[model samples]
Target: MALLNDIDGLQKPDNHYILVLYPGAETYESLKNALAPLISDLIILKKRGFNQIGGYYWSVELYFSSDWKFLAICLGMKSANTLHFCPWCDCSKNEMNTTSKKINKSMDNIKVNYHKINGHTKEPLFHMILLHNWMFDELHILLRITDRLWELMLSDLRRENVNEEIWKEKILLEMKQLKISFQFWYKRNSNNLLHTSLMGPDKLKILRELDLTAIFQSRT
Candidate 1:
């Protein structure tokens, strides 16, 4: 029962957060660096595990608990863990077929309906996507599922006005803002799979001016 903590009056941090659920340790750290700007107002960053005490079911509850602004799931290794029953993923196996394992399993004991879902969902959080390693584990069904989920969530970025330095960093140097960089491939690739080829850790470079300008425009 890891209830939400009221850190800094951010009662339900997910409301104003960019909730990230990652698996591995190192990539988790790197993502932390890239996402420092959105890490405020009691935002949460967790590395979920596959266990009984504080593992899978905990993640399932935390994930489906409430409507969040954005939920980003790092679909690591084709997300083979639950296959059809990723709590992070709302669609079930019977309806989506992508999650049929849930349907095949015994739900009488679990008390979950593997083939059905409630209607009128709040928007899913984050920009779920896959790293380039989609070829590693080699589960074609899971691979396709990950790819679809990635593109489906990315379509909501609202990039129409455009913000170059979308994430932020700042200081004053020799007559200039001594700013650091931010990544935006997560922004670009999020739109469509055809554009996924443009992804790379370095592909998204956002300096301060562009980031601010875009943020400002979104206000109007």
Candidate 2:
């Protein structure tokens, strides 16, 4: 789904417009074909300003926003786990932890080098837009961070020899108390615990209302 939001307009759910909705798998070719019309429109809008009422001409500035995976796919970049993991920079996995590196990538550089770029795999689908205009959704970032923290917490519990059933039960009970629907289940052949995928609001509730410290303290 491609949602168009007016950044200068009202900040509400109703203000957003759906540009395209593709139900198939999100591959580079699929996305490129799906977004072709929208891309053409954007190119025209950028080149020729939109003419409104009363002889007014408004210039449009496009900003692409999505989760990391979708953004990587659209940009024709490698997956986040690759050696050069960052979409915005040439920073490798080793340099990601450092703070001294600067963002030296731009749309011009990517166009000039194409597949030769460290992180980029192919030509970007949205080549009309500048690289700096592409943004990562904040809500997705929060959810990803929450997932990592949850995984680390589970690892710590396992390290302390905490019973899996006990911890799972405690977590479900806490989630229920907080009015957040969560559960744990095992796959057909796997012993790993799979839980319900939480939305932004539910994840926020877990972060703020779910008492993790108390649960950890009470693991007897």
Assess every candidate by TM-score.
Answer: 0.18, 0.85
Which portions of model 2 miss their true places by more than 4 Å?
Answer: 1-9, 161-166, 185-191
Clashes of each: 8, 0
lDDT tens readout by residue for model 1, 113-192: 42243321222122221212112222434445555644443343344444433311121121133233322344564642
Clashes of 1: 8
Error of 2 at 210 (Å): 1.3
List clashing residue pairs in candidate 2.
none
The alpha-carbon deviation from the true structure for residue 83 of candidate 1, after best TM-score superposition, in angstroms, is 1.0
What TM-score does model 2 achieve against the real structure?
0.85
Question: Candidate 2, 204: how far from true, in Å?
Answer: 1.5
Q: Give the TM-score of candidate 1.
A: 0.18
